[model samples]
Target: MNVADKNLARVGSDELAANSPDTRTRHGKLVSPVITLAHGGGGKAMRDLIDDVFIEAFSNPTLNTLEDQARFQLSDLARYGDRLAMTTDSYVIDPIFFPGGDIGKLAICGTVNDLAVGGATPLYLTCAMIIEEGMQVSTLRQIVKSMADTAKAAGVFIVTGDTKVVGRSSCDKIFINTAGIGVIHQDFKLGADKAQDGDHILVNGYLGDHGAAILNARGDMHLTSPIESDCAPLHELIQTLLTAAPNTRFIRDATRGGIASVLNEIAAASKCAIEIHETKTPIRQEVKGFCEILGLDPLYLANEGKLVAVVPANESQAALSAMRDHPLGKYSADIGSVLPGGRAGRVHMQTSFGGKRIVDMLVGEQLPRIC
Candidate 1:
């Protein structure tokens, strides 16, 4: 086994402790094994949850950084003059299978999309499976195969993996965690903190389809339509944009918090004011109607296949054209631009009728399990 595989094995063994259980001599106090609501509530309770679940599942030197992200050293691409790009994410969408894809497919595509939007050529991935005790083995096999197929289609490999079975109630059904590595050309320096005055904001396709599709699967809603999740792998689109405009300021895929959250994060990171046009954002008619009826803002709903690109005015058209040619970005549009001066990192939206309003992150998530 290679370093990644060996490190993964050490982490697994650490968590599993002994092959057979010795309850009489078990170490530690009677901390409840039944997961508590406080586990998800952000606090020490949450920290304990991370320790018992995430850390125990995938502990390693790289992840020991404990930062919101991981940093590592790599010189594998010296020949191509590229800088290494790395990112990790976990998928726990309730309904594993939905309109556009299942959890297996989403896990691979989502991680790849993150690196792709960051201007990286996605290469390798690590997948970890959290399976519920009563989950059918046949179903598990199907999901794993689906994941393998998606990775193959994306030209990436599942280089390493870890699996664990929890009590049925301990998790929804199944959750997947993915870590990815990619190579970014040395000349490319895209980041959320790089937006500048007059920078254009563009999105590749209509938003909220993924969230809506998942909601529909819940069976609690009283509506139905042909709307499906726009889950797609975006590495190809990223490559096209990179080939056409290697100098993009920033690139991002709107996932859990949606486009609005992504834009807010970018603004805060770059310390710039953003002004977006309400009329310019592209939304499918059915998605618009569904949001209105459900009292949800499409802006805050999740999306898996859409991307936000910030580019210089000179290269905006070229970027848009390149994105539009891709099957996943046929509906690309310029939704907004950077403002010169205002509340640093604040976002403003211009209503079609000519009024400006502040757009803030959703107080609480509008939709849950929308990876």
Candidate 2:
């Protein structure tokens, strides 16, 4: 028997759903208005939800086979690189749907970027969903479609996945977890400890847009602005930058604690001092205004599509130029550099007012559940 047949074997639809007539059709699509516990009961109802939702959205030869695990040819993996890279992330952002992206997009971007920052080209992903029983099927379908579209755009595939339904109060609505695998070229190497003194620091584009957008989306402050989450895949941009500056020392997605946190981590790891110029930092004025009003510092805000790169001083120009040419990095800038002669893990910022201040680790979260 084929894998798809095996996945639905041992029980005919009539035998599996003797008590739940009319809940599904021949292809195992749910006709119910909303999700129910039976959808996760490992029977015809469960198969119906999978066929109607996940299998339909992420249809591919490997996934359509409905096997429990995704298989790959060893030669295909070796064709890309000498080493394998893998990363996993879960998305539990409070508001599932947001201005620039939803939970689905955030999950894909987060996992993909985690691999990209380490110089990996993402290939395959596994998705797992925990859906609330009372949630609308339409909402679930929408999120799945978003994930499939984003994966395709990023040049990756969702090859395997699992689904579950829980009590209405157990899960907020839906939460998604994604695990990705990628390959790193034989010659590629990257690490925070690899940062060298005199290396120039660069950022792809504006910071704090994702943080500001999420905060505004929650409606806690009751304010409005034109900010949207900067959630996006970074592998392509990273590849372009590497081609221009092959000696790049390190790259990190400025996610939860923002660039301030990334710099501190880099300094501590490399045992070097670093400094940044506020005048050169790229931040949207609206985000700055949002931070000012909330008594927050834009430096510590989260970012989904931003990264901190350390490139040798000689190649910084090439790196900046390459990033600027990419669709996602038109505002790329050289924000700072690793300072010389003080290797005590210190990071400082030169404010626009010509005053110097220490840039330290974020003590507490400025925002919670922000991917």
Candidate 3:
């Protein structure tokens, strides 16, 4: 089967497992219904908790060994790629559960995307959680199940993890930190500073759904919409793009600071200017309406599943085609291009109303703890 077909098959299996009543029932019986301080005391209570909740859910030959550190065979890793890419990220978004995903899903996809954008095939992840005392065990189980399902769909393993509990008010209900390892083929080279003049700028799909969905889910705005977080794993999508446009300059997931921040960083690093058309940028109608109501610019909003790629102008169509063929990038668009020298370290956007304006890095946080 083709790459997309294989990816879809895995996703389908993951969804079945995620939605199965048997899976939920099994997880429910693994631990106490509510977590207490003893679970983190590093004693018998901790051992039982680990075995029942984490180990039971994330079972694999490597993790089953339960070593302090996971060991992989060098020969096994060498077959995949020569270089290893490592990334770490923390997820603490409010309302733990959001429209499209939860903290668990965010932790997995965020780390995987970090590796994928660097031309790496993500391989393994380390999950570390800090749970507030008195948190519901069912909540933890659900999050762990989500993580396991995501890892399975992405073809990665959760090889190691740690759990800690703090005072009831010491932290949010829970916080998750994930570190990922990936393998980059020796033939590929990618970097932010590699952007050059005449390169085309592309985004995988609609932007800012995660930010808008989270804000709405919080209910503080007293507004509601069908917007959902665009959380997803993009390793397969990246692989497809790389196969189509081997000379692509750089790829970055539009995460915390959105595409605007990523573009500004690229411009500064490559000492080049970028020009994008506002009309070309894709934003969901719901997200656009939500942002408009709040007087917020969607360009500055965060995206969980979206990515910005800089590719040679000659390969722009090929790259766009590859993205459009992928499930995660159906709304992909060619947003802009890198300008020739003379306007170094600047980003300009052509307004929908036929005006041009500079797009700069955000002065301050527009949304806090947005993951």
- Clash number for each model: 0, 0, 0
CA-lDDT, candidates in order: 0.75, 0.86, 0.86
Candidate 1: global Cα-lDDT?
0.75
Model 2, residue 100: what's the lDDT? 98
Candidate 3: worst-modelled 10 consecutive residues by lDDT? 19-28
lDDT of 2: 0.86
Instruction: Give per-residue CA lDDT, model 1, range 1-371, as digits (tens).
Output: 22343244234323322222322211222144444444444556546544554444334443433444433333333432357778999998978888889998899899989887866667667776676765654566567777767876776655455556567588877888999977665677888999999889999989989998999887787576888889889878776776667678998898877889989998999999999898999988888898998998888889989888898888899989988988888999999999987679899899989999888977887987877
**Candidate 3 wrong stretches, greater than 4 Å:** 1-31
Model 1: lDDT of residue 55? 44
Q: Please, what are the lDDT tens digits per residue for candidate 2 over residues 1-371?
A: 12232223212211222222232223877899899999989999899899888878887666766768877766666666788999998889989999999999999999989988988877789999999998999999999999999987886778889988999799899988899988787767999999887999999999999999999999999887889999999888888888888889999999999999999999999999999999999999999999999998899999999989999999999989989998988999999999889757999999999999999999988899888
TM-score of 3: 0.92
* TM-score, every prediction: 0.78, 0.92, 0.92
Give the poorly placed runs of model 1, Cα more than 4 Å off: 1-77
Better of 1 and 2 by TM-score: 2
